[model samples]
Target: LGYPCRDLLRAWIHELDPDSRQRVVGRAVSAPRPPQLKKLAVLELCTREGSAQVVAQKLGVSRPTLYNWKNQLLG
Candidate 1:
């Protein structure tokens, strides 16, 4: 997704309640061999293909924070 589109989707997702968030996460988890799991799945979808800016926006976090998480996960 483009930066603006991703940002909008991120905001929309962030505004959802816990149950809604859980539903989205559950869908991601159920996808066979998905690259994401749990919190990571939420992040991946909200980002729409691992776009750092989108992920940060959805997460209400800075780009550096997203990078740190990625590093921790991949390292």
Candidate 2:
């Protein structure tokens, strides 16, 4: 997964109930910063030719965030 998706997932997890959030936070705390979410999104967008809008919608983030990811990947 890519940074974009990981960020979105983190945001989603944060929105959950306290107990659920704690569980997720525990798992995430031990995880690396650039998690699979970033790689997955990059692969999905590059290899599968997915759209930024679709990815953003699914990830529940703005299109600008997706664009930032794309820019980061391209750079």
Candidate 3:
């Protein structure tokens, strides 16, 4: 009864669509991670094919930078 309005709104959303909260607020509420984690994620997607360019683009870094991160993290 203290915060029925807010609680009811969340409950309604949950009842209508269980995934609505995730779709609407999950990413928004996520805590910011370090750059190393992002670099590692991008590196994991890298393959022997043309993935370097694609992943590098996604990380906002150059191809050489991606390779550098790979060496830094893996080697």
The model with the greatest TM-score is 2
Error of 3 at 23 (Å): 49
Residue 20 lDDT in candidate 3? 67
Q: Candidate 1's error at 20, in angstroms? A: 45
Q: Give candidate 3 regions above 4 Å deviation.
A: 1-35, 47-50
| lDDT by residue (tens digit), candidate 1, 1-75 | 545687777677777743464333442232232344435834574458657677668656567755665665655
- Model 2 off-target regions past 4 Å? 1-34, 48-50
Best-fitting candidate, scored by lDDT: 3
Best-to-worst ranking by lDDT: 3, 2, 1
TM-score ranking from best candidate downward: 2, 3, 1
Candidate 3 residue-wise lDDT, 17-51, digit = tens:
99766445453344554777766755565654656
Candidate 2 lDDT for residue 31: 34
Which digits, one per residue and each the tens of the lDDT, describe model 2 over residues 1-75? 545677787877777743565333443233332646666666666665667778778765567765666677777
Estimated TM-score per prediction? Answer: 0.36, 0.41, 0.40
For candidate 1, the 10 contiguous residues with the lowest summed lDDT are: 26-35
Model 2 alpha-carbon miss at residue 11, Å: 38
